[model samples]
Target: MPLLPPWFHVRLTFGDGAVVDARAVVSEGRITIGDLSAGPPAPPDGHTAPADFAGPARHRARPSWPRGREGRRLVAEAYRAAQSEGRDPVLAVMRETGRSRRRSLRLVAAARDAGLLPPRHNRH
Candidate 1:
């Protein structure tokens, strides 16, 4: 039996302020977003990702830290501490990780991707 294709739930916002919330399927080197599929996806054979994937939650390699998991945990803690202490969390992550600014940013990105950290607020 053939396995079902992966499904993604997408919310696309247009320049004209129109938003479309729809589902997509990935199959046979193609991505069919919303009602554009050539055909419906096959029934699940229990080998596909969750049907609600949003196409942005794919995992990547995790950078190693000095304290291992503890050091990784510190990224969150230090960021919070910096926020409460009125310091830059990015800088604090660098200081605590003894990592460069680029690496610190990568760690932060990973945190955000993992949903462990919320997206940063933008102030005008």
Candidate 2:
């Protein structure tokens, strides 16, 4: 059977490189639309999108640290450097990554979770 043209067609491209095609059909003067995908569509080029990309396209911002294990390693190294230099670790991380104190703390926690840093003695 031949496919009939939709009454309306629209294409949407998201900031994270997701593309979606929407089509509406009009039958007996009633409009019908198809169900959308449960999740965002993959990039059109078949290449994997950057894992670091977060949030919506319009408000997208790059992360301060590198992605994955390398980022954790870097954070652990920064903490070690700060301790060696007798400077505050959080402040040192802030200087190195230009991230806020809270964000630096989170990064430090991630580094510790990655086994790059020794366990924290005090629980908060």
Candidate 3:
């Protein structure tokens, strides 16, 4: 006789703003599953920005912060290099970090302000 495992349920939210609910039942490593959606895809949460550039823009242009897989890899490499070389870690972390200058500067500045870097003394 084959033994049966328990059922598992999951809820997922997709990038396109769709929500899905699914369930699965397993028996001896073989599984059967079913899914059902509760409602139609929902629109993004907020009001859409005006398409026209006729009026002064209300928002300022801000550089996107690196947070994805590749970005995380770059950051890790930079940090490791900085640590091994005994340099200002953020400086090494941002040098050619593949991010915009503004973002790089902000990263370095934030690290410095947070006391991650040793205080530098002015020399004549």
Candidate 4:
């Protein structure tokens, strides 16, 4: 998946009495803004970010994923609730996080690995 630029909706007014409503896509240090009264901005189509943009020298690594035992506990709790309701545990995580299926599965697996969930048994 490609990293998307942040977007901001702006209404610019020039001294010449011209008003322009634009959506700005900001990536790196550059911004692209135009009359984008259209619907939502499109996915970042092949926009290449500089290598340094990913380097730790310039950018600090942010903790996007939940961390620590508490987080794992939460994931386990969600899984248990869904399983009790006869819902797909992975789907429950996906709905709660709005994350990809793979990521959600990883989260649930982590929770199980942390011993928050009972070990899976093969029930023939």
lDDT of 1 by residue, 99-124 (tens): 88998998877776666677778567
Model 3 agreement with the true structure over 1-124: per-residue lDDT tens digits:
8665777897788776566787888776677786555433545676553455246779756545465555555555676577788886566655546455677666555544555544455566
Give the Cα-based TM-score of candidate 1 against the true structure: 0.41
Candidate 2 or 3, higher lDDT? 2
Q: Which lDDT tens digits does candidate 4 get at residues 1-124?
A: 9978768999766554345688888777888884465232322565544555334586444445567887788788888999999999889877776677998888888887888988788577
Candidate 2 global lDDT: 0.78
Q: Candidate order by lDDT, highest to lowest?
A: 2, 4, 1, 3
Per-candidate TM equals 0.41, 0.46, 0.29, 0.46
- Tell me which of candidates 2 and 4 scores higher on lDDT: 2
Top-lDDT structure, candidate number: 2
Write down the lDDT that model 1 would get.
0.71
- What ranking emerges by TM-score with the best candidate at the front? 2, 4, 1, 3
lDDT of 4: 0.74
lDDT of 4 at 73: 82
